[model samples]
Target: MTNVVTCFLRHRTAVLLGRRSDAVGTYTGRWAGISGYVEGDPADAERDARREVREETGRTDATLVRAGDPVDIEDDGREWTVHPFLFEVDSREVTPNEEIAVHEWVSPPAIRERETVPGLWAVYAAVAPTVETVASDDTHGAAWISVRALEVLRDRAAVADDEAAVASVARALRDARPSMAAVANRVNRVMSGGDRTPGTVRDRAAAAAEAALDADDAAAATAAERCGVSVVTLSQSGTVRAALDRARPAVLIGESRPAREGTDVAASLADAELDVTLTTEAALPAELAARAPDSVLVGADAVLADGSVVNKVGTRGLALAAAREDVPVYVVAAAAKVRPDEAVHGETGDTAALYDGAAPVSVANPIFDRTPADLVTGVVTERGVLDTEGIRAVAAEHRERAEWDGGLEGAGTVSG
Candidate 1:
């Protein structure tokens, strides 16, 4: 029997299972999702999730919705840990495989009662939802909902008055117009696509913030004026650039190597009237340690649930330096940047370019580094300033409503 790994796959209404072929060995008749080991790849978790869906069910059109924590199990005296990934597939396309002798499309409770494998059972429980299924199909649809509409519905449901539902609908209608406008503008920017290199993501983000202000000048100006300095080890986002213009705080921009995104940040800050200082990546620690600014803000490419931050190569060191100096480091991020998919990826950049072709250069230029939760004092959102715990709370709230209201549709509702 070949050594085989097993995973239980689930969709909105049913769990997938497979009966192993006799030649495959262990648990020849046992049902399971597609599972295999790919050695030496750190992206195993993502790869496994995709592979399982395609191999077992012939559903290659699914995207990973989330990756849960790992579960350890022992079978036949061998111990293995399975990393479960929650995926949304078209329920309509599900068909039993030849290896799957008999399949069941049971509700969550029924699956819990019948699943035989301990590891697969645990994964099912973790991903199961309590709410009734709203829609089901052979293929899973994209999880898209306007943030504003969801908020209005939730708010109405929370109230205890006859007018609650009416208020909610009214508010949703009022907000939806602007929300759609914002999305349209962003879509236009992408469609027009002029100089949209990788560097332009930041530029686009900043431009969006600036454009948001046209609807309400006072609020936009206020957001633009919030006092916070981004001690960026790389380039600042268009959003951050707009904020700096209004806030006008001193910036400590670091010359992050190869990319030199910091040069871009410094130049932008200078253009915005913020007192800008350029320094080497290594100098960030000393510069922040020397004095306390109103706050040290940085942009994140991605963020983990435990509040670890992933940014440019030198971010972790800079965050550490800030922590030691009693300085608060705030991470500026959009909801889209929050990656609850898997363990934070720490690798950031090409090592060769990071070292500038130096001899004996074995440099690690992770495009994103992890900033532990303790070091991050707060998060600045279009909504407002949130401390570490507060950020988690807000995120939790978002997660709870993610399915029904959609993720961060009323994100602008929190805007200054």
Candidate 2:
């Protein structure tokens, strides 16, 4: 029924609270922080907080440390939407108006000993965890970030189910690792789910991110079904490995040099009971000609608008060789790998990794390379088999305006 801004002015280890005076309209004789009814838009909550602090405590130099996610509290029949904030004050001196009888700086542990207003403790309890998780450095991969992001959103939804807050959280997560299309896809789907309450947004985001793994598995199965009896692959890709595991086809893995990612792939395939043969980059042509695999399957870090794929190094060369051999080349990847633009390839790898025995001889070892669209027979994805046209359609459908503008800014990592 009313919007209020509640601010906690904090020192090193304690916070300031006011004992309500009989002159105040509500919560008389109860302990609370500096709070007042929001007079205008919720966006003005910060300004309102500053004004409340100056008016109640006569402190004009409090620095805002954190603006927490808002919490909704039910008082009698009216609903009080409380926008919580934490401010650091240099001085603890207080000059209370008629709204307060006394001001006390209380330590966190001792706050409960004093009789506080309803849902006062719940305010910090609701917002702190979500804020902490969002600002934490523990989040790394797509799956880890997805789970952590959803946790923050769920907590945020419990307090304020506002679009602005949800969108803010989504953008932060999406920008966490721009190279990860799964993050963007999950967040975009949730944001585009129409104007719903915060709870709905949080729920949809959680479900989308949680189901991403299963969706990837389903896509891998489809890719494997499309492959032939003997498949030649370069580099290591989780999607490709999944597909190969499901298909159980005899594999010819090129020893992706500089990094030798293919060794890992070969080992995984061998462990899965699939016949595996590992060949060096220099000997790939001879190996391909000798083995004569029916198909070349690889995984894409990004599938561009032109339907070309960007993957680990040596993919372009392998595809060219496969094309010359008249073998079908398939990219086993999830739909999230599709991008609106060509990926920004990073600098070459550490040349020292190529040959420790060389000094004057220069080495060029890039991490990834582009394989032309013409070389690719089709892209196998969770959405089923997709040709160049199909990939283009996917880009048109899911690629947001922001992606088209710059293509996931600061995506420098070479991941597949």
Per-candidate TM equals 0.41, 0.56
lDDT string for model 1 (343-384, tens) is: 443333566565666478677654545677778765555555
Model 2 stretches with alpha carbons more than 4 Å out: 1-169, 195-198, 257-259, 343-348, 351-364, 401-416
lDDT of 2 by residue, 163-232 (tens): 6776677677656534445556556666666654776865665566456656667778988887779988
Among residues 3 or more apart in sequence or in different chains, the pairs in candidate 2 whose N, CA or C atoms overlap within 3 Å are none
Question: Could you list the CA RMSD of all candidates, in the order they appear?
Answer: 19.2, 16.9
lDDT of each candidate versus the true structure? 0.49, 0.71
Q: Give me the runs in candidate 1 sitting further than 4 Å from their true place.
A: 1-234, 354-362, 387-416
